[model samples]
Target chain A: MSTDTAPAPGAAPPASDERLREVSRVSRLLSRPELGAVVGAVLVWVFFAIVAYDNNFVSWATTAAIFNRAAPLGILAIAVALLMIGGEFDLSIGSIVGFAGMTIMVLSFPSDGGGFGWSLWPAILAALIVALAIGWFNGFLVITTKLPSFIITLATLFIFRGLTIALTRLRTNRTQLGNLDEVEGFALADTLFASQFEIFGARFRVAILWWIGLALVATWVLLRTRQGNWIFGAGGDANAARSVGVPVNKVKIALFMTTAFAGFLVALIQAVQFTGADTLRGFQQEFEAIIAVVVGGTLLTGGYGSAIGALFGALIFAMVQQGIIITGVDGDWFQVFVGTVLVVAVIFNNFVRQKAAQR
Target chain B: MSGNGTPLLEIQNVSKYFGSVIALEDVSAFVRAGEVTCLLGDNGAGKSTLIKVLSGVHKPTKGKYFFDGKEYNFSSPRDALELGIATVYQDLAMIPLMSVWRNFFLGSEPTKGWGPFRSYDSEFAKRTTKEEMAKMGIDIRDPDQTVGTLSGGERQSVAIARAVYFGAKVLILDEPTAALGVKQAGVVLKYILQARNRGIGVIFITHNPHHAYPVADHFVILRRGMVYGDYTKAELPLEQLVQMMAGGADLEVLQHELEQASREGGEEAEALAETAQAIESELDELEEKGND
Candidate 1:
């Protein structure tokens, strides 16, 4: 019985040579999914830092500006990453941003400006409620009707954008809402959403802090919570997860809501900073957020990604967008650079995932 | 036999219809604690549909379902889980990219702390996963290793261990050994025995009589969506069980037809008759041994 119980063929390892084992261990670490994003971020940072040396692109002020520009996209990308990992997409997120900003603007603008003349807090609350409702509707539709979120949210994307445009035109007779700075209680809301602080002699927007905070919280939730486990299971294989009693539908719905909430946050920040809202404020933002998420090493098919990877991805985007101008390159090349980076990042992520699975 | 207790789960005269098609018809089986009820069938024998009904993925269109001798209706797999019926699907109910410990505690995670501060207890999950697997005689190199990297047999063991550790009173495995090699199938069969030894009723669904005979305490043979035969281990020997599963009556008819064809003389007919005679002798030898 004891001899029969010996390890089955291919079950036991050969005698371990310490050096070879150490080499394999290091190789395993290098093949982690996020390694691609980390490498991409480093290469972009170094290249830009060298090329734009004359512009002081490496200096604190320029770095702060880059991060400021990356902040909103970073926040949205993190939420989108979570959604993607949970096996869904929200093409309506950009429209949600525009709708949310429009909500805040129209509700807070003075009565003379054909607005509700509401105080800043009420307007902010109303905007948040609307964002939440849109998110819930998207989630409900996907779960109850069993349709792809891509198609459902795509339809809502146009519907919401059209509603924003029509609502603004009907109520204010214009496609823009302005004069937010003069609204009652604007100062407090501004401080909360659009304030700036000095850090190491660099002017940093509060949105950067919000971005970092959300990323940290997201990472913690994904790595340390039961809900995070459910998210992964839901995305990986819904049927398998359902067999084990994981509430795959609920997890997906919550992820949609989280993405929408992130959109609202970004819209609120942009609205406060500009003291107005444009009907097309968040045009194409949905694609950009998804690009950042993909660049961060999240699988397009879902069930695998990291919040920190998304942070690095957002950082890479900011560097390229700002670095191109600082280096005296044609602005058109920014799009080219972004496209190249997206392709390379996806290829690198695929290679890493394959390598990691090999062992 | 089988602890001589009330059935843990009983499906009586269950019939399932999907639209105008019959997926399962008049299938009945009872599983008792501390025993393994092997549901054997060939492909298209409604084994999958029967397992789905038992696991609460579908409700029988006509039948009475009983758990612990009381009538029960489960609307979803979640409801079945609440009643201590855990299912180990053929896919192993796992996220391939996740670590073994994470997959082990996928749905029913253990949490520490209180309220908002409460979080998954990673240490406990890892330790428990490793310990449970070890109890089944599986030595996992690392709990943090992704499940996708594990071999097919290892994945099946992990799924079985998970079901046992999560307080399952009855375990339903859907073709657990169907995709495995001979040795890997042996590994899963060992785990099935381990689960049964722990006083949990196990429903082992498979088509292979060789894999089922070693551990099964009771056998329910299904054919064309209905139960063809039911027998305890003492009443059904391994050869007879294999014969039943392979549709013995059909094989007998084929042999008779070949013998008749042989009388109408040709080289091909003579060859067919020779093959038929060989099979007849083999069956007769087995029957003689069975009598002995």
Candidate 2:
């Protein structure tokens, strides 16, 4: 409602009205969580830059490698971030990655040849279908049974892990998949995953570009798309959203599928690029993805997060992971540092969320 | 009733029950373009059930409803919304974390492009939201601001503006100023008038009679799940309306008993008199409270 009173009927409008300007000023700073994250990102970048430059750790190659490694994680983080923003989580994504890769590898193998025959396109398609189905199953349980996602996805993680073990044994009595060089469509699949290009005298993999493109699309959807708006509404207040006509369950299901699709994409990339799969593949990808999204300023409680922030969060994560190696720090200590960052990022994000919620 | 402008929504002898409890009975209301109808009742007086019936959250068990003068039955709120009946609740029926423009176009968002891959038109949404808010005499600074950041009254205004922009011919508001500061309540009341001036029929539901007294073309009062009275604006007497809402002669008898005890010269009697005085003041303050 307008704070200013309405103009009297048949009366001349005021010439020097300034109420509109005041309201415009107040509404400009909308979501504190995202704005704080943007500022925090810049500050973190500066701090890291100082550390890198002081240690003579600044190099174009280092930067490229950082992005190259962070790219896949960034893609996964975007997916997880969207899910979190839409008010759910997927602990099963880690297992989904393993399952998707294993599915592709086993399918590529000729059943009679005792080796992966590698009909790449069909294998990839089948893997994707399986991953989507897994996502749908997760959603179905979440909606129908009305269980918390944490417990649902935890059950899924174990189930998928156990299935992987049994399926591997049934295939070749071996825990690893191998010998898919003879598969049809391998070249096209390989190119999509393992291709490289040179930019500004720095070589980067196709996956990094893919990550950037995905981030761009995600950013647009979050800020400028109608579905993106529904994600926020449904996550923010499911009952309120529904009363106003938002389809809460559908949005959540779509988010789950998106997360699964991201895992599937990552699995395909890893398989085609490395040309192999193992039972243990992607064992902790879900935690890493969640950490990336949380550090990107997404709330654990759902609603109020940005895709770009998630990408930067992933960037920070990869920077630390690779920067430690470049600085000759023990790789084992990297996990400890990641835990600390997660705690700090969550605290900062929560503070911003609180500030934003206040009138 | 607008003769040519047929009632957009009409409920005839509606009755609703929750298991064995009767929520509403023999209730009727009509909404038409170019007017505001105020529904007034105390808490537990069946206002909510009545609004639910109109909004199609629940179908009345014993009534016939007409939309655009055609008999209608709705299975869900979505069905009612599709027929251009929008209900803005006290909470504004919006996601607080979402930007104003985004909230303005939540479920029925305007999209560009084609087919399943169609993209939302951001520029259009922002521009149109800004224009509509301005038309409602609201001076919101940015369409990108989250609705949470706006004042409670502003959020209510945005919801009203959204409904109007989306072509809601019948707007049902439930206690729009029930939880607001005095100024904030005035702000929402102004928006109610704005909606009325726009020729969109409005059903303003509230417990506060003063809120309904000024702007309502018709007033319908409910008590214990049934209509106590219904009157055109000209037929309403403010004093009589107040007394009726205060339980008529029963309250007067209680006042007499308290006065008799006061004359007996006991501390308890004085306390009772003070209590009676407090009630009298509350009755006087009802006008002020209703403004909020």
Candidate 3:
């Protein structure tokens, strides 16, 4: 891939082309798919500004709502993006989320028809254990079987989904869990999640802050840490990375586990914040997370992506979800819009990637 | 150093088998520090199997392996690496997208401080990688540059320098110049010599006699999983080494077949003669192709 070299012994080496050197920097910037996405984002915002005339279109409330709704999805997207960049996938995340949330609900088991005897720490710890176990299971199976994660996790998705349905039915013969009267459950949801802080006169939930923290942490890991390098190397070229002693299998398994943990954390938050669990909770949410990650310029085939990109991708999705309502368009059209964005982002990302490779 | 240097690594009575198929049988070779031990063989001549054993990708089914005068049996590639036995495979275990410094310090990345707080010392990594490569006569100004952007020869040099920097007692280069252009091949051959001069035991595996004849202090030839011959630099004759690898008997038969076809001349006979002439040229090449 390197061009700098002396001509082989007998041949006349060609002179360095200054023009090629000058263009290299430009090419390097364009290689980051985020650049094109940024451009696309700007274009979309301008289009909205011009076309969307409703008061909600430019309102502070609308903006906060968009960020708020996108926060959990953003966190999930960042996790998936990291795994995708590492060349693996976790279809079990949605189930892990359901299970983790259910575990939290179960831990806060109301003793007297209202209050859980346990504190938040114990509940959180229990949730973490369940999440990590699910994650570890995903990693273990994927690594051991050496099968496509898609198939492995797909099977897990069904297993978890079926388990969720069965347990919910057996416990209450109903779809949702609710006993909002408990003080412990109430405090857990309100203080840790439902609680809000004011910024620029717009109320933002702690969940959004958590989402931002996740993105920042993910960004740091992907860029600054050795683990991040291994993820890229593993996905880019597993054999090459293994030969270099990158522990390619371990890195991939860890990624799967991380994705599952993120899913579980999100589910736990949802359960605590909402004060209940729904049997149908987290259904098809994996596709939404994948959509957000893809929109953020993360390659579906893995090897290159960013947590920041995925966050912005989630932002884009949330914006459109809110924007469509502000425009008074049918809510069902939202899927069409997401579908369009997904295809366009994928195509645009491929182009940017190809250009980057050529450079 | 002794007159010809002491053996840094020695393999005795090594035999490898995959099911009923014998890959290497009763093969013995020794690599001495400050010298190149060239392992030459034609395709399907057990070179790959021998390397797998040497590099710890495989443990010889039956053998006594010695390194630094100590017995060894490596369970994994990492174990081999920890023993200061480094192998730069033909493709070179390099991550193309990673920066030169990162690839240089791939497995053994340097860290500052200690314990849970220890982090990679990027500055030291970049500085030392550049400095060391420069010392190797490789002028890589920016260690931040991705290895994917380097030429084949330069990649090989980096791989070599990395192995040495990591304190490899013995460097086994698997056909470093096999895929390179003539000039690129020459550049790599020069590095093999450099590694030797640094008092590193070098086991250069190649079928090319031309590349090996000049640098090798000892030569080991393998055929059908068995050693055809072993010769020290003083005893090794380049032509004979080439002839052995080419399957001397097969080459003679090919030449005889060619002469009989050429002597029976006609339009059809001429075509047969031309085919025979081609076979003769191939046999003729066996004489110097190894050296070339």
Candidate 4:
């Protein structure tokens, strides 16, 4: 968009415009935002496949396990990726998870045993409503106060987490709520949230379906829709988007709410699977999701990322995390691996973008 | 185009105030279809403020604003845009990472299908982008290329072409040639004429009289929030336009003041004398260009 020289009219185009003509397949591949993540995922999977072959990491059961673990985080990462692309961060989702989970447990458990004893469906609905409200409030604060969402969501992270602790302890006299499987609609809730089905002799959780399904939908929305263009425009330059008649504030607020919904979904999945809820559930999951998003090729600075990229990021993260345990590597090396991969992925992303930009 | 037909845009006695700052006072300008109305002014001469008032970013404190001869009050830029007025700002409201087609059809993206299934009409967008750019006489090799890949002049041309494609009856360009090299400025100036030839009333805002002279059918010269002169091409020649754009007489007075101060003969006064000499040569150069 900026070069000192003007593009020569017709007789002889400048070298810069001429350079754009060399659109080789390699340059074509470099322009995709997900290229780095896809390449990194392939390398990581190959290295892991070779190293952990003896540990049965090659089996379908391991695939199911990896996906199950990756699903919850991946689902959140997809939504978080969208938010990041829209140019905001939600540190509140990690705490939103705890709050929503507690909301379900508190409302559904019998009051005789220090619970409201409400039906599971209502409790689930209520928690989702609260989650969206929290998301709205986070966006409202960020928008109205004109503070960076980093600060606003960070504040809500503690505020919501504290509310979960204070409210749960006030109602139950204990931070942890257990035996949620005993709730009235637990059977239905469990079926919907934690149902496992065998596919080729390996059990797969429904959450994996949610994650992949959401990833597809998000990818479509990001790449092929007008809203997608607005997202990029909003993140790339808010004032520019505003001048062009894009509803930037509304897009951002909706994105924040989407992350909260993601938190609620993850909370339901975990609560149903574990048969319990606690104030400290999903601690640091927000940061973990951000790491996944960044690794997925979504720019931390926003405007230049994709949900599919984020999904691959989560996949790589989950593979490495479970790979360490499966291969008998020290747990301490997990963070080291994650840290190194993140930096490498970002550098690779930048290198590819800059290279593409040169042409 | 102006006296024979109703002007496409007419602002009479427009005055704007930011708590008595008087950004624009008693300024009147008219833009006629198939005519280029160049708003030429130096810095702080209310060029931006007048564009803002016209585009509805700021309301005129007191004025009768007319579009196609109908008195109109625009509360927002969208209102003006919907009424066939489009402002192509200096920044051009473009996303550098997005493709040319994407940025070209940004706010008004074309979609296929309906509801959630509706998708960006990629084929139509790309074809239209290319066709539009071609119409402007700039051949785009690829619409998929990001706008950032284009040169500054090309980017400005894209914005102009986009507005034209979207049916902007009145095109407002803010400093279209201000930051461009000679060839680039000529590129933008050509587009301004192209837009006018298409019967779109173009308000080409700039401080450079040289860029505006050849293309402009009408000139609205502003100085200190008021119209210094408004003239037709025949009424104002290129030399006089350039002289008026700069404070031609005021430059002489400033030179005189510097000469008087240089009599102190300190090191700083010597620098002032040198600065005055530089101004004298610049004025002389302007005089030389004025003759031609």
| Per-prediction fnat | 0.58, 0.55, 0.21, 0.52
Model 4 chain A is weakest, by summed lDDT over 10 consecutive residues, at A1-10
Clash pairs, candidate 3, are A1-B149, A2-B149, A2-B150, B209-B290, B210-B290, B210-B291
Error of 2 at B28 (Å): 2.1
Better of 2 and 3 by TM-score: 3
Instruction: Put down candidate 4 lDDT per residue, B119-209, tens digits, no spaces.
Output: 8777667777787788887888888888888888888999999889888999999998777776677677777767777788999999988
Candidate DockQ values, in order, are 0.34, 0.34, 0.20, 0.31
List model 4 lDDT by residue over A17-134, tens digit each.
5634666898788778888888998898888889999999888988888888899999999999999998899999999999999999999878987889998889999999999999
**Sorted on TM-score, highest at the top, how do the candidates line up?**
4, 1, 3, 2
Point out where model 2 deviates above 4 Å. A1-56, A112-118, A199-203, A349-359, B1-6, B114-118, B249-292
Write one digit per residue (lDDT tens) for candidate 2, span A124-226: 9989999999999998889888899989999999999889878877876778876555677878877788788887888888999778898888877876667
Instruction: Give a tens-digit lDDT track for model 1, residues B1-292.
Output: 3667889999999999999999888888999998889999999999999988998889999998999989988888788888889888887467788899999988888887778877888877776777778887788877878888888989988999988877889999989989987667767777787787778899999999877877788999999888999999889987798889878898678757867877666787767557645544544453333224
Scanning candidate 1 chain A in windows of ten residues, the lowest lDDT window is A1-10
Residue pairs that clash (backbone atoms under 3 angstroms), model 2: A1-B157, A23-B141, A24-B141, A109-A116, A109-A117, A118-A183
Off by over 4 Å in 4: A1-26, B1-3, B252-292
List candidate 1 stretches off by more than 4 Å: A1-31, B1-3, B252-292
**Cα-based lDDT for every prediction:** 0.86, 0.80, 0.78, 0.87
Q: Is the docking of candidate 2 incorrect, acceptable, medium or high quality?
A: acceptable
Question: Of models 1 and 3, which has the larger lDDT?
Answer: 1
Task: Provide the lDDT at A136 for model 3.
Answer: 82
Q: What is the per-residue lDDT of model 3 for residues B208-276, given as tens digits with 9 covering 90 to 100?
A: 986787678789998888999899867868767777778889867876887787676447777755664
